[model samples]
Target: MTRRTWPLRAWTLVALAGVLLLSACGEGRQSVLNPSGRDALLLYDLARVMFVGALVLWLLVGGLFVYVTRINPREMSRRLAEGLIVGGGVLFPVVLLGGLLVYSLPLMQAPREADEGLRVHITAEQWWWRVEYELPDGGRVTSANELRLPVGARTGLVLNAHRVIHAFWVPALGGKADMIPGRETYLSLLPEAAGTYRGQCAEFCGASHALMAFETVAMAPADFEAWLAAEAQDAAAPQGEDATRGAQVFAREGCGGCHTVRGTQAVGQVGPDLTHVGSRLSLGAGILGVEAPDFASWIAHTETLKPEVAMPSYDHLPPDDLTALAAYLGGLE
Candidate 1:
């Protein structure tokens, strides 16, 4: 190729790569820019305004620098210099900053207003989330790894930590609130659309902190009500010989000491509630999908998927027993 053509081709490749990289940031379900809730949309709007304001400020500064360096000092008047100093350096910044503070302070306080809709309690552990929903009858339903909400409902989340500090953040929903030990914090979200969003622990807690993620599903009012009803019920009885045998294995393996499944003898409260484990979209705090193969793998090698996790590996179990156990858990839906 000719030299001119080669330079053109190189520029084209660089432009293409830049476009591709920018596209990746726009496509994720967890991106704050693609907000789906009222608070998130407000934050997104503020971000856009600030971004544009920064660009304008940069251009003005650059222009001033160019004029100063290119023009002769003798040609510039003393009044012009003083005007630039006061206007650009002091008054301009103070006005801009004051306006921003005024605009954002109210948004920060909006979440603190009373919420009359659903209330959820989320407790952050080393690498997982314990989710509890307050029912209308004053009872509570507990679950893990997945959070469900009604679209267009103002849901209040009461957040706390079981051990160390963590941050509960779902970018598409709203801003994050810290989950601190010995203290309870709150965040309010009003999802505007029905879709699935991803959430993660924004603060680092331990070795598996990066894997401490969950899914947030926003459904219609009717669908959300039905889901709540099902979740409030006890786990269904295991069917068939394989599933029955698997339930027996689960009890014999001492899995009941850390986990709980309603309507069963397993009543341990140290781990995530597994009453509807099969109904969850993902397993192990969003590390893997809820499927037969993934379930078996998680059971056989918990540490391999999540390092420094509290659960022990059950690789010593025979292949048949493992398969049966996986089958039984997968049928809990």
Candidate 2:
């Protein structure tokens, strides 16, 4: 058989062309190599260039082996051995060291300047997210499960954990950052467009860690301001006779032991604040939709959906009582 250099080069070019075509499609949402932030995109480009260069090196070395082995069997003993050593010993280290240097360069540079517009604190708990926003007027508001920010503005996030380790990440916005118990970590992201982004607890904290999800809503500045105002309003309890009965059940049945809703009593910080939960996008830490049947099922039997959850089943309640309670909680908006 004769040595062939054409095949190796052809394959390398084909792979490169495929990558270019994928990039050209602007599949930012689906592309692994596509990056949203300036820092991540810069790093991704450098790494991709290095990867292509490495593939070319591999092809050239492999082609050289084919050349020596086939063209002259007599010289193969010496030439092939020397080629193997030189290629393996010299090229491998150079490629590895080169890649390391390329990846480390950006780490030494100072981080980008912090944007003055938005700042929010995120704290990870056992099975939920605690989000706090620092407003321009020096006031702070805290909520759970859902995060709302001004669209197109650069936002700085400070991450912390109350119990165990967790990772905070929103794939569309940026990469992940660890939430350590005692240490605070910071990440900055700018949502280019206004929409909803889904995120989860990347670290395994406990049994319900997978259920520990959160949602981010990026809205226009005017809309965001309106949302903030609405969230800050005092709680308004349900007024109808059925809703009044439901409120009585909530107080009698020990629902106040874990959750909180402003005014009219029921203040327990162990779980999420239901003061404006009806107005939020989703419920149960984004596990279920905020609809009548979903809420009814979840309140009636949580363990059936998620085994060993902190909240036990309220399965003993009668159907009418369950319906009334669900209606009352739904009216919290």
Candidate 3:
């Protein structure tokens, strides 16, 4: 090869290798390869088998190339060529794929979650998830941007979208399902460990589709029960001077028109329920911290941070009112 061309090719290979190495370096629990649940493990195993089978096929082709070019460069008999074509090419692929189909299809089925367990209904909006827990008692608690599941239990999920289609996927837990408009899709994830995992909208819905994400927290059974009980309760009253003023600002600005806070008159269904917003892991559909400052920035820069969102930017609010509003919302826990 020419020297100049060789250097360019070498650089390309180096870049590819760098990317491959970097992709393996992840600390987050959002990888199917590092599965945290049963269905995810099944998927991982099936993928491994498929990958290994494909690798063997490729290696066989490479060996054929070496045999024909280097070991013995001679024309084969027509009879031998036809036999290779029929046996190795046609029959081999049929058997391989048929075996794979037989083995892998059953691994894809989700087991029954439970005879009596909590059910989660998730509705996908343009760029956020509206999460609701259907209690065994028939009452439902509304939440957003975060999902909590009890470890060692299969929790059933009913997913749908508001206006457009979206896909729900938690890589470390299980496969994805499409969330269609006016149609419900079902999935069940049984987490084996108590840890935090990340989930995202896998389908391209609109402008901020890539930014649509949520946190999944697999908790111990007792802790999950307590948290669910707390979630069903009304939001705690805002405390402190700033928080009280913030509540007033929230009312004055008519923020309740799109959001909801259970204990107050701020009941609106257009946006997420803010009854316990402060207790959430993140804000703005899991894109920002739940801290007071994060809330302040979101109130001021909604359009800037998330384009085409339903919530209008409240950048016109005065600085004091904004701060107070942030304080009040942050104290909703």
Candidate 4:
């Protein structure tokens, strides 16, 4: 009735549960532990080393406490106490941390852009991204809230912020880079596999900072080239009577003043390039889906969905007109 201890199997089950919980946290595209690139792999390796060292230190100190309190219940000799305090407390951590610092210095070096390789210029807006690809042939193609890259290639990203400072981070790909106004920073990622990942603005900039995210898609080189070619084209004409009516609404409502649809006289550059918004994987900078309902919701609830957003709500429009407008935007693909 004095004390109780868990059975070995019970302890084992608890440990297993803890491991499963930790693994679940690292299972998604936004996790650094689920590394798909060279730089992320380096970071994962460093994390493993540090975790193991901390575990070992905890075990050593706990073991010494258990021995002194439960087993012997006696004071240690002066020499043993001094040695334990000096060696285990001082020498071990210094050597381990010094080695870690030496190992991480090279990994922290500035990214180098290889001549003739891929280069992308990214500008961080209040709650979105402006992505421009500098093609090898000296042409520029623009997109928004989505980044595409080729597998097994080192892509150089030139980054800057529009107003406040933001941080560009794709945890599965690499570390964070600060985006300062009027100053260009750089980050390089060498993707080792073809997959979709999530990137976010790591620094706190404004009210919608947490909602500011994007998608990173890594594809085969051929597929990436084909996609780029398609993205370079202007938007297709709106189809059907409802879509046509919606296009008229788009014009009459003066949506063209802020957005550029790239083909039919909607060339304004104050906001994201919606040249192919209908075909994008997501909307509202990865916060909404690409379906018609999603489009309507974003248009109708701009501030409610994304606080302090620059785009005004179009809720005043009639429901039929809204549906038509959504359909027209969807057909831009």
Give the Cα error of residue 326 in candidate 3, in Å.
0.5
- Model 4 lDDT per residue over 214-285, tens place: 999999999999999999999888889989999999999999999998877888888899889898889999
User: For each candidate, how many residue pairs have backbone atoms clashing (under 3 Å)?
Assistant: 0, 0, 1, 0
lDDT of 3 by residue, 1-333 (tens): 863365457657976997899688574688886799998888989988998887677566655655666566799999988887787778877888788899988887774333356799999997888999998778899999999999998999998999899999999999999999999888889999889999999999999998899999999999999999999999998899999999888888888898899988988999999999899999987789999899999999999999999889999999988999899999988
Q: Indicate the residue-level lDDT of 161 in model 4.
A: 97
User: What are the models' TM-scores?
Assistant: 0.91, 0.78, 0.92, 0.88
Cα lDDT tens digits for candidate 2, 1-333: 124565566767988998898767654442335454444455556667667677667676665655666544454477868777886669775877687687767653422345677788888987788887887788866688988877667778888999789998776666678999999888877665677777778888888888888887878889998888877776786879777787788888888888887786788878778877777777778888877677789888787766556787889988888887877887788
Those runs of model 4 whose alpha carbons end farther than 4 Å from true positions after fitting are 1-26, 110-116
- What count of clashes does model 3 give? 1
Supply the global lDDT for candidate 1: 0.88
Runs of candidate 1 with Cα error greater than 4 angstroms are 1-21, 71-79
Instruction: Report model 2's TM-score to 2 decimal places.
Output: 0.78
- Scored against the true structure, residue 187 in model 3 reaches a CA lDDT of 89
